[model samples]
Target chain A: MAKGRELKGRIKSVENTRKITRTMEMVAASKMKRATDRVAAARPYALALGDVLARLVRPDIAERFPLLRQPATTTRVALVLLTANRGLCGAFNTNLIREARARIAELEAKGATVELHVVGKKGIGFFKYLGRNLASERIDITDRPSAADAASLIDGLTDRFAKGDLDAVYVTYAKFKSALSTPPSTEQVVPVVPPATQGTPRDFLLSPNADVIVEALLPAYVRNMVYRALVETVAGEQSARRTAMKNATDNASDMLTLLKRTYNSARQAQITQEIAEIVGGASALQG
Target chain B: MAGALQVSVISPEQVLYEGTATSVTAPAFDGELGILPLHAPLMTLLGTGTLRVESSEGLKRFHVAGGFLQVVDDTVRVVTEEASLVG
Candidate 1:
């Protein structure tokens, strides 16, 4: 009986863990739903803004814009990598880092230098191990990031681009596809390039003037791009946590099932042995 | 400045304020600048401070931080750094 005590204790511990993992799974599920909705709600506006901005750049103003100008060298690129502030979800940060490293290598293959702008703490700590200096980053921008915060960061990126300190700006994050799937993505942030097949801009009124309107829309465009990525990253994080918890729950349940089987077999074997001993003793007494 | 000018304050997150107002006053880096209806088309970089838009009822104040201001045609668009309306 005491020999099986260790197994019993192990089972108890596992059950406790299963309870916690189950709770975590539910919590992650709720968060995943909220984050998914947030990303979806924000998309139409961002896409509309992007499309509007694509057309707003008049040919003349485009000539003077530094962001539009091509750089002499492609040696150095600035990567703005976004990851969750804390670690728990499996492979979330790892996959992002893997993509970022590949992107860096690709840029380097083009003879460009690479700089990191780590958004979350995990990225900062990871890149620091390789002796990289982050151009600029914001931490603790989880839950819902304020539009202003996104704008402020874009302002910094704009400065770097204007100064020609960076050849191009890139952002890497996990794009939320669904509750079960999110893929890591690297996107170009600046030079305001619209897809070739973009639709025409609507003829909205020029409130103050056309130039002012364009100017207003440009920064908004930048903010939209970054905020969308951030929101998507959060959603991806939640989904990853949910998936990890689900696996843990399933594994625990399997372990408990196996233990129950072993426990029954062991109990039956002990009962049979006891009966045999009692019968043998009675026969020996009668003899 | 015959009538109220249509002004919209937009951020990346959402459209903060969009309506018609008699005048718009903002805190610029050097000083405060006011925009009126049919104001000359121009653009200026905004600094940190509160922005005010006036109407017949009263003046509404919005807190804003670093961004730019632009006026084109007759519309005044303030793309603020950080914007919050007075409660």
Candidate 2:
């Protein structure tokens, strides 16, 4: 009886866990759809921007643009580590943190002072635990990151880079390739690197001339890069959460099945033992 | 269709319009610029104002701010980060 009762309690607990996981999986699935749509929706702008840049920027034209000027020697750098605030999502946060740590290590080894600017509470907590110095910590941006949110995150940093206070800035995030694969990658955001001019350049009537336009466009370009990274990181987070919840639900179901089988056998054995005791007592009374 | 230009109004969040337009009037940084078919390759920074596109369906207007416009051959692209449809 004791064994049977204990098994029943175990089964009930597993059932509750299964319910929670199932709900989480469904929630994550819906969120993933929206996040992926954002990814697609943002593509046209990126393409059009790239189209304009490729046609507009050249080595000679970019030479005068401060943002496009690559630092001769990278001495001071800033790294923005993006992680999800909550932790239910598998290794999503872990992978990003690991990647950021390695990047900081690599930069420091090269005699560059790495300034750690972290977003999301999970990353902040991890760094705080290690007593690492953080230039800034922000937990305001959620899974749905807006352009304004991105601007707030990168504006000050870019201004510093332009003024030569910082040599370079890099962002570390999970690159969403697909639902099945999201690898943590680091991308340089400052000292804006223009894509190599492709094909033959077209000569167009420049509106405010090339110099001013390129200067303004480079900052926008940097903001776009940061925005894109945020969007992709969000998508990857949701996908990872869904997969993790799905696995959890499956495991819970399996555990419940095993517990039920053991409970049934324990109940049957107790019934047989009681019957045997009754028969023995009756035989002794008759003798 | 001979004189129609292929036009696309693109914003960061979504594509506002994509069709053939007879004419397009964009608010360039300095002033308003109009385009017809076979316009020479041109690029300009956009200011905050109305963007009017006239097509077979009728005229489509958008309020766009702080972006750029490009025209090459018969293709025109109006890309703005902040844009919304207007009556």
Candidate number achieving the greatest lDDT relative to the actual structure: 2
Q: What would the per-residue lDDT of candidate 1 be over residues A1-287, giving only the tens digit for each residue?
A: 75466668778888999999899989988988888877876664565455455545666776566666667777667888988887778899889988998998898888888877888878888888878777776786976766655666667886778788777888898988887788999988876664443654345433345555455556566667788888889899989988999899999999998887777777788889899999999999999
Question: Where is model 2 chain A poorest over a 10-residue stretch in terms of lDDT?
Answer: A192-201
* Model 1: docking quality category: incorrect
Lowest lDDT block of 10, candidate 2 chain B: B9-18
Q: Candidate 1: deviation at residue B2, Å?
A: 24
The alpha-carbon deviation from the true structure for residue A169 of candidate 2, after best TM-score superposition, in angstroms, is 0.5
| B-chain TM-score for every candidate | 0.89, 0.95
Interface RMSD of each: 6.6, 1.1
> lDDT per model, in order?
0.76, 0.90
- Chain A TM-score, each candidate: 0.91, 0.95
Clashing pairs counted in every model? 13, 0
Q: Could you say which candidate leads in TM-score? A: 2
